[model samples]
Target chain A: MKLTIRKDQLNDAIQQVSKASSSRPAIPILGGIKFDVTHQGVTLTASDTDISIQSFIPVENGEFVIAKVERPGSVVLPAKFFVEIVKKLPSDEIEIEVKDHHQTSIRSGSTDIQMVGLDPEEFPVLPTIEESESITVPGDLIKSMIRQTVFAASTSEQTPILTGALWNLSEGQLKFVATDRHRLASRTATVQAENDYKFSNIVISGKTLNELSKLVADDNSEVEIVVTANQVLFKMGNMLFYSRILDGTYPDTSKIIPQNFKTELVLHTKKLMDAIDRAYLMSREEKTNIVRLITQEDGTIEISSSSTELGRVTEQLEVKEFKGESLRIAFNSKYMLDALKVIDSEYLFIGFTGAMSPIIIKPTDHPHSLHLILPYRTTG
Target chain B: MKLTIRKDQLNDAIQQVSKASSSRPAIPILGGIKFDVTHQGVTLTASDTDISIQSFIPVENGEFVIAKVERPGSVVLPAKFFVEIVKKLPSDEIEIEVKDHHQTSIRSGSTDIQMVGLDPEEFPVLPTIEESESITVPGDLIKSMIRQTVFAASTSEQTPILTGALWNLSEGQLKFVATDRHRLASRTATVQAENDYKFSNIVISGKTLNELSKLVADDNSEVEIVVTANQVLFKMGNMLFYSRILDGTYPDTSKIIPQNFKTELVLHTKKLMDAIDRAYLMSREEKTNIVRLITQEDGTIEISSSSTELGRVTEQLEVKEFKGESLRIAFNSKYMLDALKVIDSEYLFIGFTGAMSPIIIKPTDHPHSLHLILPYRTTG
Candidate 1:
């Protein structure tokens, strides 16, 4: 393949796909980024057997020409070397030519780099989705949904299914739920989908979700999600993100979510977070990460943590509205901070269904999202 | 100790001395910061055997009162927990009170932390530096000198002396030199010093130099450096940095610096660095970091590196002046970039004695500093 491409466009395309390139691939060819050249554009593909990413650089973008193809062919260059070379190439215009035996030459400004490439045919092909059941969602909404729920997914490989967040779709409502046994995070939103379309237990790994978030464009752009039996593809502008759904069944979390509350409180999200964040430091020193929250009779919440070796920490925060019984509960402050940081609201509605039951936290403004943390049964 | 101090000032003082506090200490008290409070101010000190740092906050600086001490006493608080707590404290004014048995209470805004502390009496006291001979130099110049020469120091513990850059202060001139056997780097400058007093072979570890660099305020302030037989102290305003000198004789590097050159070239520092930086990426993949430089007859220098697995990279750079014989030499491109990065000049003067001798590099405008790099013996 012989082509001249813009350095910036090539850099962005390489970086987007590089995340999926395997650092330690089972197959040597999997370590490379496959280059598919044609008159229309050049598509760069990389896969690590699980997640595959493909980015395309069209011949023209808007008013400027991004690439000019002299010949159409395919080759797979080392992703590690190619990524770094294009990033530091001293000129705006880069010329690439692949000669016989896959000896590829890249020239920009006064620097010329010659790289030996692998056979592109050896690279694995991405499975094409039927696209019969697909939903379109705003890029920012999808990103926010992933951020709110993905962190609660289990990082351990013991239960491989828990490593992914389940996507539940019914009617026009899209929801995501993730739990690591100790805590659960669920978010719901209305997407631009068919009214009768429904899919459940479509789980994608937390790692893949994070990579997809980066691939999605900014706020105004919309991404189309095409779900298949075992594979899911997110189609954004000029880029496609593909990942395999985690095998096995997702545990039913509906029963664990609390329906009744013994006590409920409304507090400013930032204030409560700031109070719990300070207490987290003391609890972290004890390695238990346990922080206790006690509701006072006069509209205040006292957050405290103590260890024999590290003394004690007490934080007082005033709640906006309190109803029902005054209660005391203890939970992991780290998990609490994580949930609070992503609640895009000024005020939060927190409810407790007794000390042993799960604690529910929901943003008052963005009621579609909710975070749950299991309270620690503390003797104090 | 009982005091109300500005949170920002207290945080700054703690961080400066926290670097000296050992994470794993021979004595447990060394893991804490010793706080001494007086009506005049509050002083914080920490030591890790090899290095000790102390910072003092007076009652007022300019128009702002930093600390108001209610009682005069001393106590030691755990550095790790204490640093994190003060950093996130919610109020500008932090009240610290040391009760009986070193039980310290820290209160800021609505957050209160009681920390289990160690006895201040057990903490190692910093020895008084008998300021017999001292030199005051601009903080930025010393920082720059450390940056220029410290990277060449050996990291391996095999040669303890080589881990430190040798300091030679003679006749109001200060020079720093470091080498790892294969390559050498030297930078020299004129310092404000007594003409009659001279000191040589005072070697300071690269690790300690790096730590000291972070403590130096900025370019405007002057740091008073006190030299002793075993200990060196750098006083920068309210902070005192103490580090022990390495115990060994520094290797003489004067003989390795080639005075007469068989070939000489002057080139733009940034352009040469940019080209070498690109070639370094290719050489790094080969694991040897070998980049060859050949003086072309057309007044251009060709920088290139090649490996069988990663092909080759060639960069052409034009030089302002070329004199004497045309020569070809190879060296580690990583080290070349390091030397060129600190030249502090638009044009760099480089001289080569032969293909196998130490190459001399100096800034055309700044005559005080010099760097010498040993060329690699390559078949090409």
Candidate 2:
């Protein structure tokens, strides 16, 4: 196999695939990235059994040539070392050729690197889903939706299903829900899909989904999502991302969300977040990282935290508006902070169901972003 | 204690002194900074037995003022937590007060914090030194002198003396030397001092010296270095830095530097350094991280590295001039890179003495910075 490609283009493609290449793999061949050269373009594939990433660089469109294939063949080379060499190459274009016994030689400028190559047939082929039930969504929406809910997913693997966000689709709208049992966040968006298509029960590993989310950009590009019984594929631009799905069912979090509240308050989101953050310094040393909130009759809210070893901190937040009777509530400052960061609105509405029940925090403007957090027990 | 200092000024002072405060200290009181409020100003001091830093914020000179001092007293507060709180405080001016029992209250904006403080008597006192044996030098020159030699010090404690830099002064001239026994770096400069006074054979820990160097800037300000039997003090505008001297005799490295060479070459420092850096990508997996240099008759140098398991890389560098016959040599690329980074000259002269002896590198324009690296045995 022989091919000539621009050093810059090859460097970018190599970096993307190297993210999935494991230095130490259960199977020795899994440490390499399979490179295939054809008349159309060059394709690179890398995987670690759990997550697989493949990127393709196509040939010239009109005036500029991206890559030229002298002979169509395939070989697997060491991923990490190959990427490093390509990134540091001193020339504008690089030429790669494969000889007998899978020996590969790369020439760029005055530097020539002769790397040991493995048989491409020995590398595992990542499973691709059949083109039966596929959903196409805007790349920007998926990226934003992932960022909004992925942080709420459980990082623990004891219950693997909870470690992944659940994607449910119905009536041309897609919803993502993530919860670690203490707090839950859900985001919804509309997408064009087949009229008869419906998906609700499939659950992907939250870790794998989170990794996939980072690869997508917030743009107008369209991405196709294809799902099989045990595999999921995301096709974005020139890249293909595949991950294995979790085997168990996700827990039902619908009942945990509160439907009514005794008090509701509307305040500037940024102001409240900063105030809570300052209070957090003192709360970190205390048990439960608890911060108390007291609503006064004059429509003011006071945030306070104390530690026996350190000291105490108190701050009064000026509320823009308030409803219902005056009351006091306590909750984990970190959880509330996380819930507040996802709110896209300038103003947020926080509803309390008493001192011990779960509190609902929703965007005062955008209704799709919902956050529910459990409150910590407080003493006088 | 009372003060109304600007948030930014207080933040900078806290940051500078906190460098001497370690979390895990032998004396618990050493983990806190002592703040003494006098009629003149407020002085902050932090010490960790080996080094001490004191910064003064006068009442009339700085950007902010120590607004009031109802009662003059001193108290020691936790270093890490206090710095964090002050950095994130929401107000321009912070109000601080101390109670009779060492309980301190800090208020800024709507945020109020009351932290537990310790008695100031428990804090360690900084070392006292007179100014009779003092030398004055430009802050920029001292900082540059430290940077050029400190990198060659041994990071390991196998030979404790190798971890300190030898400072020798005589007849208005000062020299700094550091080595790990494998490579050596030396820098020298002229300073203003008494004609009859001379200081020689003083060794200071590389770690402590590096920390003190950071406080000096590349400006025309003068810094006074006071040397005593057991300690060294640096007095700047309003800050005083004290460091304990290393308790060992430094080895004489003057005899190790070669006075004659078989071959020499002059080249642009940056161009040769870039070539050496590219060679590192191929040599990182090898035992010695060795890179071979070949000087040819055509004034071109070849830098290359090869690994038995990986591959090989060869790069060519153009030299301005060459003397003597063609030669081939191999050395550790990391050590060469470290030495090259310290040279301030645009052009550098490299001298080789046989293949097994140490190679010398010096700036073509500046005579202050000099480095010597030992060659590695290469059989390939």
Candidate 3:
């Protein structure tokens, strides 16, 4: 493969594909990145058995020329060293030529690097998915949804299915749910789909979804997602992101979400976040991470935590509004802080069914997203 | 202790002293910061046996009232948690009050934190150094000199003295030198000192100097350094940094630095640095980090490196001046890069003593600093 590409363009494309390349691959050949140069442009692909990513650079895009292909050929190069070399080359234009026996020479400015390349036939073929069952959603919306719910996914490998986030589509509404048994986060948004097209139990690894979110360029750009029996493909601009779906069934979390509350409070999000954060430091020393919240008769809430060796901390914040009953509850401050950060609202609405029941929280401006945390039992 | 202090002033002082506090200390009280409040202001001190740092915030500094001392008292608070709590307090002014049995209450805005404190008598007292054997130098110049030479110090604990930089004073000149057997760096500067006060064989840990460098506020500000039999104290602004000296005899490195060379080259520092940096990446894979430089008859130098598994890279750069004889030599590229990065000149003068002798590097504009790297013997 012979091609002269712009340094910046090639660097960006290499970085995008390198994300899928694993440092330790079960198959040694899987650690390489496949480079294909054709009359149209150059395409780079990398995979690690679970996820595959491919980025393409056209010969000409608008008034700029990203690359020029003199001969159509293909080769696979070690992804780690190849990317680093390309990034540090000291020239605007780089010329790559693959000679006989897969000997590749890269020249830029006064520097020239010759690297050994593997045969492209050794690489695994990219999976093909039908475009018939596809849904279009804004890139920004999907990224936001993934960030809001992905952190709640279980990181342990004991329950493989819990390591992924479930994607459900029904009645033009798309929802994502992730849970680690202790806490759960759910976010819903509207997407453009066919009336009869609906997908359920499509679980993608939270780690893979987070990588895909970073590839999204802008909020207004549309991302097309196609689902098949075993794999899911996300197409954005000139890049394709593909991942394998988990095999197990996701548990029904809707029943656990409380519908009504015996106590409710609304307060500014930043004010409450700051108060709990301070209390968390003290509780962290005790290894419980438990912070207590008590509603005062004067319409204010007191947050406090104590450690046997570090003493205690108490802070009071005036709530915007309170209803139902004044109660005292203890919960993990880290879980509440994580939920509060992604609410995307000035004021947060917190609902409590009882001292032992799950507490539900949502943004006051929008009710599409919700977070649930289980309160800890304390013998006050 | 009862005091109302500005949040920012207290936070800065805590951070400065916290550096001296160790996470794991031989004595438990060494992990805490001693707070001494008087009618003048509050003095914060922390020590970890090897090093001690103290910061004083006066009652009034210029137009800003840093602290208001209502009563005089003393206490010791855990450095780790204390720094974090003060940084996150949500008020411009923080009030710290010590109740009975050293129970301290820290109040800021509506937040209140009660922390358990240790008795001030348990903390070690700060050492006193005589100002008779002191030298004053610009803080910025000393910091630069430390940066230029400290990286060459040996990090291994095998030779404790090598981990420290040798500080020598003679005829109003201060010199610093560090080496790890393979490479050496030396920097010299003129300081204001008593003509009769001359000391040699004084070595301080590179790690301690690096921490002290960060505390230097301004380049033009004077730093008063007092040297004692076992400790050295540096007073910069209102902060005092004290570190124990390494007790050992430093090897003489002057005998190894060659005065004459068979080949000489003067080139742009940045250009040569970039070329060697690229070659170093290839050599790094071979585990030698060795790059070869060959001077051509046309007054240009070729930099190249090859790996058995990864092929090779070669780059040519034009030299501004070439004299003596054409020669080829090999050396560790990392050492060359480090020396090149610290040189404060546009053109670097590189002197090669032969094929196997040490190479000397210095900036063309200054003769006070020098770097030496030993050559690797290649069979070819």
Which one wins on DockQ? 3
Q: Between candidates 2 and 3, which one is better according to DockQ?
A: 3
Q: Residue by residue across B273-373, what tens digits does model 3's lDDT show? A: 99999999999988989999999877899999999877899999999999899899999999999999999999999999898999999999988899999
Between 2 and 3, whose TM-score is larger?
Answer: 3
Error of 1 at B336 (Å): 1.5
In order of listing, the candidates' clash counts read 0, 1, 0
Model 1: lDDT equals 0.91
Error of 1 at B356 (Å): 2.5
Candidate 2 residue pairs in clash (backbone atoms < 3 Å): A164-A206
Candidate 1, residue B1: the lDDT equals 80
| lDDT of each residue in B231-311, candidate 2, tens digit only | 999988888888898888898899989988899999899878877877887788786789999986677999998887667
Give the per-residue lDDT of model 1 (tens digit) for B164-273: 99998988888899898877777878888875778998999999999999899865599989999988899999999999999989888888777899999999999999
Q: Write the per-residue lDDT of candidate 2 for residues A29-127, one digit (tens) a residue.
A: 788999999999999999998889999999785788989889989999988778877877778899999999888988887677788789999998889
CAPRI-wise, candidate 1 is medium
For each candidate, what is the lDDT? 0.91, 0.86, 0.92
Model 1 steric clash pairs: none
Residue A91 CA displacement from its true place in model 2, Å: 1.5
Evaluated at residue B189, the lDDT of candidate 1 is 80
What tens digits encode model 3's per-residue C-alpha lDDT throughout A1-380? Answer: 89899999999999999999988878767889999999999999999979999999999999999888888899998888888889889999999999999999999999999998889999999998876878999988999999999999999999999999999999889999999999999999999998778999999999999999888887569999998988999999899999999989999999999999999999999999999999999899988899999999889999999998888999999999899998999999999989988989999999999889999999999878999999998888
